[model samples]
Target: MAKTFEVNKTIKEINERIKNGKAVVVNAEEMVEIVRSKGKVEAAKEIDVVTTGTFSPMCSSGMLFNIGQEPPTMKTSQVWLNNVPCYAGIAAADAYIGATEPAEDDPLNKVYPGRFAYGGGHVIEDLIAGKTVRLKAKAYGTDCYPRKEIEKDITLKDLPNAVMLNPRNCYQNYNCAVNMTSRTIYTYMGPLKANQRNANFATAGQLSPLFNDPYLKTIGLGTRIFLAGSKGYVIGAGTQHVKNPARNERGIPLGGSGTLMIKGDLEGMDPRYFRGLSFQGYGCTASVGIGIPIPILNEEMAWYTGVSDADIQMPVKDYGYDYPNGIGRALAHVTFEELKSGEITVNGKVIPTVPLTSHVISLEIADKLKSWIQKGDFLLTEPVEEIEST
Candidate 1:
């Protein structure tokens, strides 16, 4: 189908409207109805920005910290913060810690469904919450860096450089997991009941960032976003980012697809938006809240932002068998509307479904981003380079 009219604008023009308090900004949820009622062309002309959000467990998250040089400036060969091992291969005092890195003594899955209460994710939360963590390091005792070992307590304020860099986040769509065997399964998607008694899935549905864009048209490198309650930027396409995943008729990806690499300073970060998650049998992860504002550049963008939960679909896979065996085939496909309704039918059997992501927080993030732009506190930036997508 062809559009009756074309509405076009630019980020500069949108920012000008924001400065003059004339830019109409709405969230993805509100834009859906507006586009349905006002039509795509008119909505594109009326709305200047559409904010999308997602708050879910992201395991590919970590932090880089410059803990400052020791008394004699020792070159760190091993680093541990709060008993969790850290990667010290960066610089003299700089180290990176991934969210999923477990503590050395943590009995992970050894007793079956271990309780991973503390890990790199918890350390990150503590730092952002203004709590101190024990920092320990060891050196090989070089001529210049004479210090062999050191121990100290450090907070986010104590570090000269603290940045949160997530490699893969904001998945476009994800799997709906189920267990087909007699035994229960604990996965990153949460727990699944046996015999397909229940299903678990993650994602913010229509309010998700990539779902709103459907393509990398508006979001790109250097695009500003509300990341974990701090101002952050999209660095590039994230790891395992499937640029051109299989899409349905509405151009929405069917399963795990487009992702973003994001970075932000740790200063002034709110702990509420950045939390440490301990998945029963799984190790640990971080729940990240991200909001991206899409500029209404054309009618196509407005139409894309109009996607609803009913328009989005995800594949269901058996976590006990297919997922564990590295199978990519989906047993069934269901829409977000059905998943959100708390139940879905699979193979003539009705099973309950639960969402692993928070839809309420997602809406709050969108609202917060919208308020920032409406108040002229947040401004959009043109991407330095477009993310490669076919």
Candidate 2:
């Protein structure tokens, strides 16, 4: 029961509904059930919009800081925030600290697995929470940029624009990983029990951005989004974005695809939504929360948003050692419904599934966003330019 519809005309229709405050908006998590039980045609007709959300530890996250000159006006060549290195390579007073950067003294995983106690992510968290961070930097003496070294305690309050401009955060589809090794390994995916004992997957199932719009039609430049509680936009295709990844029958990526580079004011973001996470055998990362709304521009867009969990598919990979390079012994073939059921059958064995991403929090985010759009506070946007697939 599908019909032809144009994106422009559909946007106008949705905008009119928004004006009257009667647009049918639903969280993507709920849309799946509605589509399955009520059929796509009926379900699409009822819901004019869908919002997707995700909260995960993204290693590709970091902060841009502008360390001020304290009379000395030092040129910061070497810098460390809370004993974690900040790339002073940006400018005299600016630096960026990646989430996974380790302490200079213990750069190696000598601590066995990884060091989670502190790193750039923790530093970013502390700064965002209004805590003071220790700063140490050394620079060669210059007449214009006179001072060569600086040591002091600085707070993000000193530099109000300590922004979060991540090159990457969310992924279209992620793998369900299990360890085949004898010993447990703590990783970004969380602790994977030895010998395929457990499977851990991230992403908010059907509520993920790229999964909801596999073609990147609605999500593009200038698209308003929910970022750590504050509003932001999709700046461009994120780093390492494999836009043309192979897709399954459902038009969902079999592995990871489309990524988004997002920008937002750190001062405006809620501290609760941005947290630092550490894995025992792994390192530290920033758990970023994000949400995006898709407008039902037509039955096609509505149908896309109404895609159920049972239709999405992601591969299961071995994480015992060589990850990403590990064999995808079996495809989960299960829907987001089965994936979230807390258990899934793999290799004919029913294995319990653990989500590194929080579905409960994600749902709450979606609901909060739906309320925003429903009240005329939030608006849908068509991307100014499509992300190039390379």
Candidate 3:
């Protein structure tokens, strides 16, 4: 189709509209219907921003803390928060706790399907929820700092600083996992029933942040966002970020691709949007809520935001054999629409499907972000540096 007109809008212009209380903002789900009926060109002329969200168990999530130094300070060489180990090599009192780090004495699959009740993720939740967390640290005695080892119970309020820094979150696309073997398998994607009796998948599909801006055109370094129920910012492309993954004709990736690293203050975060999750035999992780706003720069942005669940095709792989053996081939392709219907066909047999992420909460997050923009509480930000798209 030949273009009849050119649509253009800038971040500064959008902010002006937002400041004037005239910007038209819509959630990703609503954008789908608008583009379906009005077309991209018309939608771009009318809409100023499209909001997207995802609430999922991102294993790469964690928190960074700066515990106050003692009167006679000592460099912390070892640290544990609520029995979960944390990395203490950053500074004298700085430590990083990974969400998936298990407790030192966790039964962990020593018995089949072990209950991973507590870990770093749980400790983070407790701190944010105003519950006391036990902290233990060991330090070498020195002339300037002589304290050896100390233990104390601390709350979020007592910490000098607590920051949530996720290395990777909001995957563009991911696998639908199934077990082809007779025995069940436990994985980060969740447990797969034997003989493909059940299929498990993640991602909010069309509502995911990366999907609405597949090329990272509008989302990049220093872009403000809603992270775990608080205002946050995108630091840059996440770890293992794919530069240019293979995609279908519509610019939607055909496999797991693009990711974003984000950071936010852990203080004043809402507990409802963050939860500690246990994947049985697998381990513990965090269910993080993220919302990103996509400004409609042109018709292309409008079109991308309108992608539907039926239009997205993700790979289906066997966790029992394919994923574990490092085989990168897909068993079959399935759409999110089919997955959301609660069943999908795999290996020529019909099986039940379950989502590992919450679509309902994702929509709520998008709507909440929209309200923030409408109320002029949140304004669009121009990225300091555009994310490289190869």
- lDDT agreement with native, every candidate: 0.91, 0.79, 0.91
Tens digits of per-residue lDDT for model 3, 144-242: 768888899999999999999999988889999999999988889888999999999999988999889989989999999998888999999988788
Better of 2 and 3 by lDDT: 3
Off by over 4 Å in 1: 1-5, 107-114
- On the 0 to 100 scale, the lDDT of residue 217 in model 2 is 75
Q: RMSD for each model, in Å, please?
A: 1.8, 3.1, 1.9
Count clashing residue pairs per candidate: 0, 2, 0
Q: After superposition, how far is residue 288 of candidate 3 from its true place, in Å?
A: 0.6
Residue 164 shift from truth in candidate 1, angstroms: 0.3
Task: Give per-residue lDDT, candidate 1, residue 263.
Answer: 98
What's the CA RMSD of model 3 in angstroms?
1.9
Higher-scoring candidate on TM-score, 1 or 2: 1
In model 1, the clashing pairs are none
lDDT of 1 by residue, 1-390 (tens): 955447879899999999999999999999999999999999999999999888899999999888887478788999999989999998788899999988877765455546676789889999999999999999898898899899998888889999999999998889999999999888888888889999999999999999988888888999999988989999999999997788998899888888899999989788889998888877789899999999999889999999999999999999999988999999999999999999999899999998889999999999999999999999999999999766
Pitting candidate 1 against candidate 2, the one with the higher lDDT is 1
Worst 10 residues of 3 by lDDT: 106-115
